[model samples]
Target: MNLQVLQQLGMSERDITLYLALFQLGPSSIRDIASHTGINRGTTYEALKQMAARGLISYAPKGKRRFFRAEEPDKLLELAEEKRASLEQTIDSLKTEIIPGLHHLKPEFSSGNVRFYEGDDGIEFVLKDILATVGKLEEKTYSVFSTKSIRHHLYRPFPNYTAQRIKQKINVRVIALGEGGEDAEYSERKWLKTDGQVDASYIAIYPPKVAMISMASENYPVATVIESPDIARAQQVVFEALWRFL
Candidate 1:
């Protein structure tokens, strides 16, 4: 079957082949297993040693020969569960030790400092930051969107993200070109038409900063975020005027 899945489940390719070979041939020596799997003799020996260590295989010494055989496949589940438990314990210890230390290692920058976020993860981070920060500052947010970059991203669950944003009771005002109406599924509190002025523009104006995002090709989504009080106030006035009329 799929070797990657077996690898992810903690089996090396050689171990996987050796286990399957053992299952097929009952009990066999290293040379027979190597011939069956096409793995070199040294590699087959190593795989057998590892499998034996993990309790997936056992060897019985008869006279001068050692025969290797597979243990019950049900032991794989037990081994996997043991690993999970060990991982959980390690995670708990790290959380207790590391998370408290994070407070001491504070960032060198101040809050409301302009941060440029690019691409899908960057976009998601900015949106989540807005929801957390602006949700307390402004009751509403206005959005001007283009469909170019967003149409191709497979990053997050889109509808779920929109639903969560709306659930926060943060109002959204939208100014869009013709195609924008069809793409943005989040219902706008206010909708304005752009009259086809710009090419592939995405803009969001928050209290502290104004961000413009555009994707030239499918790959890089560039965002320019500015944190100037003068510029933000000017943009706010412009948005209010557009909101009042449209």
Candidate 2:
């Protein structure tokens, strides 16, 4: 069975090894469990102590020593629930306490911030951020500079992106760098002719932030997000001028 979920629940490799060993060894002393798992006695004891603390393993008195055994696997659900509760409380503290305290850390003139993302998961984050950022705006519209070369690749990470955009009532204006893009609700498109497919890149001009996505290699995508109102505004101005000319 895949016990990888134990790692997600904060169990180290040694802890898992020991916990599983206890099931095989049946209520084992720390020394026997350590010998079975090939871990040192001290480390195995500490790991078992932590597991006991997490309620993943239970110990009982046996003669002069304690014997350890894995709790029923059902305890994993309890552990997961506890983790979720802790995360929710942490979220509350971040919003109500930590973030307010962190405001003083910002400089008088904040410089542009840039972040990089790679692969499908990273691309999904950028796309979700776009919808979230634009949705919070007084103007729920943004512009895109898309190339045919990368057009197919852009939404692969977020196939339902347009659906989400429309659901959120967010609109997009596109300056397609080459032919072939579809029309959708709350969107306008204009094409820019090129000799052929140039470099595969896409740029989105969202106020206060800009996202640039491109192909690093065949079927490989990378993205960069620049959080700067000035840069976003500059790109908007250029896009508007070209939009009118087109």
Winning candidate number (lDDT): 2
> How far out, in Å, is residue 51 in model 2?
2.1
TM-score of 2: 0.64
Name the 10 consecutive residues with the lowest summed lDDT in model 2.
103-112
In order, the Cα lDDT scores of the candidates are 0.70, 0.89
User: Model 2, range 1-246, lDDT digits (tens) per residue?
Assistant: 987778878987777778788778898898898888889989888888888898888999989999888899899998888989999999999999899888667653444378999999999999999999999999899999998888788889899999999999999999998788899999999988999677999999998899999988999999999888788999999999999999
TM-score of each: 0.60, 0.64
lDDT of 2: 0.89
lDDT of 1 by residue, 127-169 (tens): 6755665577745665444443353442242335566666876
TM-score of candidate 1 against the unseen true structure: 0.60
In model 2, which residue pairs have backbone atoms overlapping below 3 Å?
none
Model 1 alpha-carbon drift over 4 Å, by segment? 1-4, 87-104, 108-186, 191-200, 205-211, 215-221, 225-246
